[model samples]
Target chain A: MRHIRITAVVIKELIQLKRDPRSLVMIAMIPLIVMLLFGVGYGGGTGKISIAVVNLDKGSLSWTVLDSIMKTPSVYVKAYANSIEEGRELVKDGTVSATVVIPEGFTEELMKGASTQVLVIVDESITTISSTIRNAMLAVTYKFQQELVRSVGGSSVELIYSSVYGPKVTNLEAFTPLVIGIVLQLVPTSLISIAICKEKERGTFEQLIMSPISRYDIIFGKLLAFFIATIADMLITLMVAVWIFDVSVRGPLIDAMVVSTLFLLGSLGLGMLISVLSRNQLQANQAAIFIFIPALLFSGALMPIDMLSPSARILANLTPMYYFVSAFRDIMIKGFGLWQITWEVFALSVYMVLMMVTAPLVLRLRVD
Target chain B: MEYAIEISGLTKKFGDFVAVDNLDLRVRVGEIFGFLGPNGAGKTTTIRMMCGLMRQSKGTIRIYGYSIPEERSELIKITGYMAQRFSLYEDLSVYENMEFFGKLYGLNGEGLHKRIRELLEFLDLEDVKDRLAGRLSGGMKQRLALGVALIHRPKLLVLDEPTAGVDPPIRRAFWEYLRGLNKEGTTILVTTHYMDEAENCDRIGLMNKGRLIAEGTPKELKRRIFGGDLVEVVLQGRIQGDVIKGFLNVGDLKYKDGETVLRLVLKDASKELPSLLKRLDSMGLKVQSAEPINVTLEEVFIELVTKSEARVRGEAY
Candidate 1:
């Protein structure tokens, strides 16, 4: 392709985009909005959970157990039930996440130096909150057992815990790479496809095809324009994720930028393919959303890829966002270098090449 | 004679429907050729094929000796096309649109700027050169689209309904510009449904139902439809139709505005009109006026279309 012709198209597209205030605002603000919403909403494990406590044992030892449960940051004792039936009623009514039952004679058994158990009844419908409450209950019971063993003149065994990659990974920090992948893929893909389809809808595509510029020039010109704009968008998102959310980029920044650029190219290529297949802007927008939803679902962003079914794993391998999210997590969270993500880079490059080649071939210059 | 565009037996089909059926056309260099048709007459399809933007289902099209779909790259360089719609980028300024098209045509730097400036001045669009194309009025948008098409100074300009919705004065001005361009050796092939605009063409082809029904100059087409000159006579008193018919080799007779009008087919009208007038004087019917009337292209187009449709119905029956 001739450079001058490509430059002309690029400049024209940029001017058009600059004039369109709605699209510009959407491109710049979507990432910020998505990052802030997801980062702050799910950032720390649902901050405060309400649970019912049934203290049937009106003794000092049971109160100590209640104090331990209350001291945990995530759990809040919302309601006091006199019996286990009342606590179960509170759980059934969805008034709280779970119910803690301290049975009668629990303090008498503990004072006699006999083993006792605290019955924790939880609602399993809200799985995440239920699991979090369960874990907190286990920790509180373990602390009471250690205290009882220490006061009774028996040796206490301690267990130590450590994280392999992140010692203090918060929810926001863990999902930062996912946010980056989603922002890079969704925004550029939708914007670029809509831009090309708008030309087709407005009847300007016929004029472009009639000109001497080749199809490659048009595609590459559009890709270049969106790439620059989306890269700037990615940088802003990166800053927000790092500074505001306290998510660190542990690997080389250049490596992250390069991999992100590759992912952007792949996403833009998918957008071009959609533009080629769709007849108008509405169709293009619909098709982009159609692809984007599936890609996000299977990209290992929502759930781990290994946990998926065998066929689902194969399908996840096909989506470019999967490789992008994996590579981004590896570089950003796992502190891996470029060599560690060679496979993901290769996969994304292949996807980029395939989509870029197929788009122009499928694109029709004539109305037919 | 060098033909700017030559097509023989061009056909385009969408599944079972034939859009352009075995069409043959030839347009000479430096001539304004009007392609007149009603809606769905395959005018746009034929123009697209000629421009090499679309491939013909069958047959051959050669624009300036460059065969379509084979030499499409070469063909696009020499042909400028304005589609039936407003095809310029709406969000770009008028000058930006021109400059972009100029670069696409391989003109750049100072040369591109100069050509854009000259075109803006020539089309009288200098005042709105900085305005977005979407913000321009209908006439201004048409002018800008025309300017973009003319940016590369192509040898052949193919315009599809270039003035479909413009006002009459703007349409006239656009035609004047086309005439100036044709005078400077630029061949133009334009399509329109407006019969009045087709009258300005050096030659025209009327298409209907994917077929070329008629092709000629405006005068030639009128002659083909009416077969002779139309003569209107204002008599001192109204004359009966049978008496007028018995006079001579008149084609059709009708009474209009309380006068006798005769459609006459003669070997030569200038030679025969005077004697016809003398006979009218001798018959004791004073002739207030006798004159040959020029037929409008609109009448010819309607007559030809009605005749073709009748023929098709006759064939079906």
Candidate 2:
């Protein structure tokens, strides 16, 4: 409650911030890297793709289809292997995003007026990408089948391929900013909190408490140092997206900084909250991870909120990451303005307020 | 003299355990009062409550007549504490540590600089002024902790187990420094398990299980504990308890620490020493040397703790 007491702690924290550079870079650099990983990663997807080839009947007609595939962009070619497991491993290791195996008796089947099936091995780790790619692959397979039937003088056979989501989006760009947001939010909240917890574990909290500073001063002091580090990292991640990955930051620069700073408050508040709850570094770490991981995963970061059941979707809205991702993507990708993100700011403010209100009450007198 | 610290019926309970029971204590202005007890005897807890670091479950603590928890902020203005461990910035240099704490007390500019300079010179820590506190020796660390506590020049200073690990010579030096502070009218309340340290205090508080069993001047406690003077005789071999009693011409005799120890009336002392020595020699006893010394804080501790425990069991002794 004392003004000087709180301010004194704030100054001491600044000195500590000046000394530790690694934490500074972590806050600034980590977000930028995550941004690029999401930007180039998700931005590169174009459309559904499939590959079909006829080795024996690969006469003129097969070459025409092959040439179109080589020339065509978006639909990636799935290299055929001798065994299905070999193809499956390729998908497993992400060597090939998806694989299409062409049947060996293709030429004979066409001559005998019988149909052959082409199997698509998809890596569902990214179910959206996998399903979209699978559809493109199956479409190519049907095209190849129809062409072979005409060449062999037989009746055309229609193919049956099913999709869980109809008319999927070819430009599935939404996941990138969401993933990047999740990582950025997760690291600062958990790692910085861990850093604070480490100070507690090492008995440095005693030093801080015994010093002439007050609790608010100490809390505000740490917040400044951590904020600088986080801002630097955010800038780095943003730069990588703009320069390297070509992901646009369509929002106003000042607006982005404001959002990042407010989000930083919310994140740091979460960190401080974890710090106050756990007495030791390990316990604090476990607690931080518990709070961070679920917030990121269930906060509609990696997957769509619609895919989650109604209850989980509602719960995801409660997390700060949900608003952050929504607002960040709106600003970066969707080009939404500050007025549209009013709710995100409101949510973050609430998070920050709750943390500011509760964290100090848990500020321990001593480990004993 | 005015009381710098006053606590009455101060009780601290966590769940079902009482760390500090209903206790009352007053520290006179500018007096070095020592609180002595073994570990886990609630010394630190009591100090913390007095400082307003921890809220007391019951009773009132007034620091400079400012009621605690209510006047905690004002109380913080005038109080400085050095934790049990040498709790200072271990990574920071001694100079940096002082400056940071100086800022905490709302000190700045030339006034802060002068105060810091005085502290460095007073503690003899000028030579290693820039050395990291982590690398300092136990004695040097103790000095630095004390210096940091004195940086703000608070009227009352409380130290919890300040020198639990420092050697004898350094401890003697630390006590001398504390006495110097007291002479300048800075009241100090320090806790220790070592009985010898309690002797340096103007008055002492003997605490056991959250209660102040006894409190008085060192001389008064010693006289009351012994009811007379303790006669200590240094010997080569350990004296048997029964043999010691038989050799005594006056009151009870007891053997302790490989020496024949007994308390007797001062009037019988001169006559008893010769006859006791002769009797030992006649019995072919190898008496290395013999001298009667004064009752010490160690004896007073034993006298009080033993009696207090016996009283708790309702045994009349």
Candidate 3:
């Protein structure tokens, strides 16, 4: 751990990275582009689901249900069809996500206080959109029943709901921490994963290891350089999240940054391990994706870890990202303090330490 | 004699393949020792083992009294290595590369800057100090690699094929620098396949198939292959080749120029030639002219490699 040797390597790394504009642009743009994609794609709440409507009943009660479905904020009536066949055609041809049909004699059956069914046809190929459409139609039916009861002068009970996060939390806001977790996890990991392998590929590793520096110096030096270079990535991700998308951070922003820094170091450490293990840049890139895709999928970045099977949950727990995403969510959305997220922070620290230590230990100082 | 590098029974293997085998060598202090071999002859492997860039599978290496792998840190301080390929950071400026390597050897501040300045001037790289190494011409890059290797003023400099692909003039100039470095008392161990270049070494070791087939001064290797130096003579008068062969010292004899010219192998050309000419004068045979024939290292290298291969084949049978 001689400071002078480490400083020398760090300075050399910085100069090389600075001179390579392509890598610099990639570091900045990856986070920006990924965040923008998430913000624009999922940010506006799944973008106005379109469905077709078919009214077969002779009474005006069917139009009331249609009006309620159209009034729901996320639902859009794309077309009106004369028969269930035509409505089904619209859904099959992908003209709309689903079709809502009112059965014949529906208002007559309701007036006699008898059970009636309204049919909804949906395209199940696009599962998310189809499920959303189904939920919207269910809500429309529930509302219509409640109104019918109120008109008859019977007492109606209102179903009220509450959330730990405020009721106004948008989809984008709730998912902001997940986006940050992803940006911090994959971007830095991908960037630093090729550091050592690139040197080895260029034939410079032979010269570098010939110097008097130790294995710790090389590993830690790269860690410091990549950390300085990519901390900007994290900042840009947060800025886009907060200023542009208006993602609210309920707790102190600095606390979120501290947690983010821990996660960032862990990612860099993981990448360093990969870099040391790989013999070439292509191998390093593939290995980075190999490890991170699993982390992204199982670590609750896209879905809750609890939703996974019990054995899969064990895999999620193994990923440092799960704890970071969970902790970031608590800090940003739930307003939890550092004291509440100590376990997450401790787990991240342990991961970072393990990787950072293992990298140098596994790194053979010889090119052969 | 004090040796800059000492090795015995050095062996290196990759899984089941042997790269360097059962090697023994010593490079004397403050002299240029050239390790010469064809491609894949284990020249680079031997250099790597000596410089501690690789670990030998068996045997011992001591550079300047520091045992390798155990005392590699100490060895690193006193040794500078220039790999066969240009391995400096190409993206870095010439000055930055030197500065980085200089600092790695624990050089810093004014002292480090002073050493870098001296090396830049010495290697004639001051003008391109700010140029990126990747942008330099082949010759300049070679010079810069040498400069980086010499930055710390090491006691020993190990170079692996420093002039493999450079043109002739640059190769000559590079040797001049190496000679200059040697004059300053930096023991050099360089490896190359160029036969002419090995002539510049104070001592030469010819390796083929992971074995040091021959080792000596350039002159000694030539004499060893031919059994003696070749000397050609012409006599004007009638002289049977047998008469001269009987008078000559321990040697081989061949005739040319219509029986007047005789080529003979002598124990020592410079010493034996005068007496042979005197013997012809004493025998009433007028001597026309005589000169020692020069033997190129290329011939010696080929002969030695061919003989060693034959021996190996014979043993295999």
lDDT of 2: 0.73
lDDT of each: 0.86, 0.73, 0.88
Model 2 TM-score, 2 decimals: 0.78
Q: Select the stronger candidate by DockQ from 1 and 2.
A: 1
Best by lDDT, which number? 3
Q: After superposition, how far is residue A204 of candidate 3 from its true place, in Å?
A: 1.1
Off by over 4 Å in 2: A1-7, A21-25, A28-130, A138-176, A194-213, A361-368, B14-16, B230-249, B252-263, B266-292, B315-317
iRMSD for every model: 1.5, 3.4, 1.5
User: What CAPRI-style quality would you assign to candidate 1?
Assistant: medium
Query: Candidate 3 chain A — worst ten consecutive residues by lDDT sum?
Result: A151-160
Candidate 1 chain B: 10-residue stretch with minimal lDDT: B260-269
- Pitting candidate 2 against candidate 3, the one with the higher lDDT is 3
Give one digit per residue, the lDDT tens place, for model 3 in A245-277. Answer: 888889989999999999999999999999999
Off by over 4 Å in 1: A42-46, A58-60, A110-115, A153-157, B232-248, B252-262, B267-290
Each candidate's DockQ: 0.70, 0.29, 0.75
Model 1: per-residue Cα lDDT over A1-368, one tens digit each:
29999898889888888888977986889998998898779775557899989988867899889999989988999999999999999999999889999988888987887877788888899777888998898889889888877777788787789878858777787788778888888888888887667888888888999999888898888888888778877787888887887788899878988888888888888998888888788898888888888888998978899999999999999888899889988988888988998999999899988988998887767765
Residue A197, candidate 3: C-alpha displacement in angstroms: 1.3
- Which candidate's TM-score is highest? 3
Tens-place lDDT digits, model 2, residues A249-328: 67786676667677767777788878777767778767877787778777676677889999899888887888887787
